[model samples]
Target: MTDADAQTAPDADVTQLEELSVTANRVDGPQAAVGSAISSISGEELEQRQIRVVSDVLRELPGVAVNRTGPAGAATAVRIRGSEANQTLVIVDGIRVNDPGTSGEFDFANLLNLEVERVDVLRGPQSALYGSDAIGGVINIVTRKGEPGPPRFRASIEGGSFKTMTGTASVSGGTEAYDFLFAGQGFSTRGVSTASRFDAVVPTRSLDHDGYKSGTGLAKVSVRPTEALEFTGVARYTEFDADRDGFGATSDGYPFAAAVDNRDTEKGKQFFGRAQAKATLLGGAWDHILGLSYTNQDRRSFAGTDLKTYASLGEMTRFDYQTNVRFETQGALPASHVLTFGADHTRDAVKSFTAFPFPADAPNPLRKHIDNAALVGQYQIGFFEKLFVTGSVRRDFNDRFEEATTYRFASAYTFDQTKTKIRGSWGTGVKNPTTFELFGFSGNYVPNSDLKPERGEGWDVGVDQPIWDDRIVIDATYFQQRVRDLISSETVPDPGDPTGFVNRPINLAGTSKIDGVELGLTLKPINGLTLRSAYTFTDGQDATGATLVRRPTHIASFNANYAFLDDRANVNLGVIYNGRQRDLAYDAATFARTSVPLKAYTLISLAASYKLHQNAEIYGRVENLFDKNYEEVLTYNTPGRTAYGGLKVSF
Candidate 1:
């Protein structure tokens, strides 16, 4: 289902509360019927809040944490329920976008909300449906498609602090025979300094402003020649350039202190394309779908005085083909049953190049490739018409590792009299080692070809209830996960030298455990007014009983939106609170690891919009309304009290 099918709240209107979600089970169905922890944000809500980056939108989500190296366009990491950044799978238009060459991690800083219609975050293990790298969760981003109406056009422009500016344009329309949509966006900003001095004792560094620029484009088309057959195609591309700080440069160490000016820049390009066909047979009881997808990514980092003397390049390409079949019987056992099965094959390859010193000969580029195949099956059964149970299994074969099998079971029960539901799910997940982890760089890392895949088992139980004439909805979930063979780097004595040490990746002998509780409340006290609040409490520990790094113990957010003046104007307010956390920093002088405590911080934002005509509107927003000084990462600068205004025209 599309984002326009339902309101902001999951249970805003009890009669029309069945919002279809495909991320939970890889099939379209009511979100409430799925026995898992899930949440979504619509494009309309994102526009109202004036949010442009995907990372900003995810900070308020339950069971999620965001850490950035600096301000806008900087490297950003997203952690779900205390899991590692690479453990969560990121999917865009049904294709995995994680970078295979970089520890299988997806950087959220580059994911702009240009033509996105909806974002669904599914918490906990989902390997039975999505395969590897789903040990933590899945983030599915659905792009906008044509609407079934007259052709529409839209344009928007905005400017904010730090010399930031953005512009976007889109066109979408649909007919009985064909539908299409196209969108483009451009963004640029002169951001704050990525690194801070901390104290006067530190060596002097260039106080230059980091700059970022990006362009994004999306196109989608669908055609239906017959009533039972359809075809769809999608393409997306993004190009970005960012000025960044030197690596390993902190108060303790300044590698470029002698240089008068640092010229460090990072450039990247990403592209994805997919084509699919669907057909119905056996009098509509059987449905079949075939899909093919391709992805390509290239990144380059430049450093030194000339900005080209020293450089590194990383590239990745992947191709996948999948087929799925769904069968429904007229008369099933007990009540009714829907059976689904699918198989997919994927090939991925990576190449890297690096030049150590100025004008030095580039090392021989490293290239690697791997193949994967998987088969999956799922069955959903309904008993007494109110209780639903789903069971799924998957088997995966990897060229570099051992074969693995995963399974999941989930159930949901609804009480018609009280409009309450109870749901629970248990699942197993796996994450294979990435190319970077298995093969070391030129001289920095040590390769370990025998590294094992990380494995996890997790479960969650939750309740959803509606009260006050269905105007208020509340949900609470408790979840726990245990992971084995956790991957980490250790300093080991070099094989060639007696006194030298090298960092090597290895699997930890002990297991890591993470558990959390999530609570959500939605209120629609009156017409044109809505409020939402969510709270999360997470506790994570390794085998050594030390808290995990960068995982907050508590997080909470509250948002309110109201419209008045004959629906011509609206106001939005949001407040977010992040609890204290811990991280480890390396002391260059002493060559020791030190635990650092980060202070807690809160942020408040306000937005308002007014309609000037039927097809035009103006909007303004203030971020960090309180001008609070906070740091999500140590020695990184955060923007304070930024204001922006924009105009949108639609036809």
Candidate 2:
């Protein structure tokens, strides 16, 4: 899940245990066949770890860094392999959910675990299949699809420290011809003060605690009237309202920019939908798929009574088509060849208004739109049923300023003697500047309409070894990446308004380098007991050789799960360690930004669940066991130790 999750040895053949991945390739295939780094977390792991938000478990993942500005519902950003947060792509089912209005990044703060069947994380440059914003990697969330069975229902509710409460309900059913599922979830919490007491700008050490509330709904349907034809579709919607802290106070007070405490809140609504049709032809030798996806998001921020201090709306419409051809022969030493190709077009539009300190002078009045189309092709060959190789290329056409080409090559070879797999991948990627950076947010933030897109290239090599009859697994990988034309913010004097200065995005003169090592181990030492651990070392720097902000150099995690009492009771424990990091701090008195050191810290959590009956269960967990005082972002206070308990029932 987080890394290499532990699982008991299966009754089936150990060497045959294979996990499927869809994000690495356009189509579903065995993870071991991808020749790239990938990991998966099942729904069972979500319930076992008592995880409500996806970010809570991402810290244990290799090559990933999670940063939350303050409390549970605060602004959360995830970076993969030392890349920028916006470089990663977030996908829900077949739809892309990255908001086009907010720097082209998906905020993990409002994501809830509702009807999630599996989460797959792909670590590599993937522009060959996915067009843009995938320079770093991809996070794919797969939802539950109904199977042929009787109707089923499930419900759960929990309450815990900090006046937190959560509830979820779901109903699913299906028949031979059609299947459907519907689910909903809700969460609310009274969080801790977002501003740190150590900050000089804080009005007082004891300020009102920030709070958050959210709700989400999901629906899915599928139809299969004939063996050669099928149709499927899904829709999801989410809404959230969260309290936030203000930037540091300005000279005249009322910080337009935050370590100062204030009653500021943010609200957002997002909706995504996708529909697809698949057909099989030529006696299963040819497969075709056509799909359409839509995304809409509206976000607003309120400063005290001013409900529309800042607001934005983003929308995207996409059409995709793909085909696959296969040629294979049945034999003792079989060899096969497959060819895959696809084309996609997307239209992205955004509009925003900012009414901060200068209501009239601000409130940017421009609406922007961008169009992009891409063609991708891939070829795969497998010989002796043990070695697989894949190569892909893509060309993009954009109405914006940037049009580029990307390439990727990968291979995986397995040895029958030791059941060990050696894998490697190399890829090139490109990311266009977001609308926000291109057009600007407010007058105080100047636009960079002439800015160029960021370009990158990377490579990785790894090995996966299973020993002790699949009871133990060890995985290790090494990766290196280089990025050119990096974008960063710089303060510049406003030629129009001589006395004031504004921040603008600029392309750095040189390249940035990032390299990392990932190691994971999982063991099922005994029946019903499992242990897992992972470690990551990353070295990231700008052209000037300064450590990248918030990129920790060392990280390690350990988790153990035990089932006893004839499998009626289960418990899990997790320990996470984050090495020192560098973060920018704004001096309250001088208002100058300076890079500051953040001490290393560790976090521990424990969860236990017991079955009360065949259809009922009770569970509880303790988070931040030591009440560790630390900060993921400078001046943002993190929550202390907290506890919660809940009951779940299913039929």
Candidate 3:
């Protein structure tokens, strides 16, 4: 479909969202018919922009913040609409990928855009449709599917500064009854120093280059045994290793003192698989789907010098089963009344081992597990063919915490004559505490089994207007969220040792608030030229009236793309700006917290591609074009100017 058609289409599903289609409701419909703020990026567009990492791709999105600890392959956190890193839910190919062992947060540093085809970002609470950990929003990643044409194979290789190298290969094809797709990718880089440079009174280790390497593979297969039944399966795996620095005390009193001869290393692996079966019944008016999914993650870290050694290992396993049913009305007001119901069960378990005090002794292996079941239902109706409304509810039962119920209501109205649409939504969400929060370590942390779940209520209203015969689109939205029973670490008296104190998790009585306004504009002034821009203003504060750390008050981005030579060549340019933010610093000796101001910075990027032949292409990209010196986190070093070039061939 043409860009204009894709942008204006009213009825779009998950597959169409990346093509400029929007669907507010999970059951599927036109974006104009659902009441929620949503955004999406197509895989084709991402490839054109030379966005290789998941963190880089999400940096400029509205109402989103990406904080990286260091350069590439370092720990990265994504916050949505002022929510904490663990409050947002991330789904890959219909499976949740959050690491249960790490406060239930997903690290974007290791997620590469290798076989991804589309990304749908739904802003606002989504607990009613997606159970726990969806208090902020939901991110859905869809992978490429085989095409019903001759088999195709493609490969590409690239190298750049920092001794970075990358290679990718893929094969896909489909027939009348069967289809399959397989892809593999590998990347390696001799990264820069992860720690910032600081003067030290005592001699310290010389600046050493950290390095990272990763390999990933994906496979998918689908079959249609009969006219009424279909089956599909998917599998994915990734392994990575990275070198890191250590934190030590310096004579200057800075807590983030560089360790001499640091030789820390981290290794991790992830695997996920899913199988699904779908059936159509009652003359295609009713549909049923059943799916089973499994995920496993392992992480190991080694730190310290020759005389002393510290190591830790963490592993997590998850199993999930889900079934869904949808019914279509036989009679309607020129529109269908869709009803959907689903249930799911999930079990998560973790095992961890660690050695403390310079390889002297090892602590007992820690093991924990949690399970939850949820039932969800949704109803959608259209009246007079111009107004639509939807309501959804979910009931969840957790093995460790109290049961919870979440609900959402939304509506949309369209003025076809003026090409204007108004939409609004209200919802409630919840997040259960992680295992580590409930049960602490051997010596450092204390357990808090009495902790309650974090609760949130939020709402949003927005409008979409089309101008210049739908060639230009404008969107504006306002949203607010209040969170109760905020969880935080607090110093408490140690029961086992009356003379000592320890850090323990506690639920605060006061509430935290987050509110924001988002604005976006898209213009297609010419057939081969496109321009887009987005801006967000956020106000995030704690109950004590203190600004949240690492959250910028203002964020904006502008992008332009132009194609020439009969669509054989294209150039893309983009700029991102982040405003000053408030943060905190702790004293090395006293451990006293002090407020700090983080300066703002802007970055520019450029990418270009040219078709060498009917089945081959050449591409190149420049990141941080001006080599702007900035840090997303204090005491962390960021990458400077970098460039890469690659060639791709398809048959």
Leading candidate by TM-score: 2
Q: How much is the lDDT of residue 481 in candidate 3?
A: 88
- In the range 1-651, model 2's lDDT, one tens digit per residue, is 000010110111112125533445555444445687876667777778888888777787778888999888888998889889989888887788888887898889988788777666678888887768888888777778777799899999999999999999999999988999999999999988887542244455457789999999999988988988888888999999888877755333432234557788889999999888878889878878888889999988887746678788889889888887888867797878878888888888888888753324544655888899888889888887678889999999999865799998988888999989898999988888888888746635667888898888899999988999989988899999888888877776666666666677888878999999998888999999988888989999987788899989998989898999998999999999999999886544334456788889999999999999989999999999999999898767899999999999999
Clashes of 3: 1
Query: Could you tell me which residue pairs clash in candidate 3?
Result: 22-31
Ranking by lDDT: 2, 1, 3
Q: What TM-score fits each model?
A: 0.92, 0.93, 0.92
Q: Scored by Cα lDDT, where does model 1 land?
A: 0.76
lDDT (0 to 1) per candidate: 0.76, 0.80, 0.76
User: Backbone clashes per model, in order?
Assistant: 0, 2, 1
lDDT of 1 by residue, 1-651 (tens): 111111111321112234533345565444444777787777777877778888787887789999988878988999888889999988787667778767787888888888787777888998998788888898877778898889999999999899999999999999988899999999999987776652224445457787899999999998999888878888899999998766443454453221122447888888877777777677656666777777777777777334442223334333333333444345455565667777777776777666642113323466777788888888877665578788989998899888999998888888889979898999999998887677535444566778999999999999888899879989899999899998977766666667655566889888999999998888999999989888999999876677888899999998898989998999999999999999766544322356678899999999999999999999999999999998887667778899998999999
Q: CA shift at 33, candidate 3, in angstroms?
A: 2.2
Write down the TM-score for model 3.
Answer: 0.92
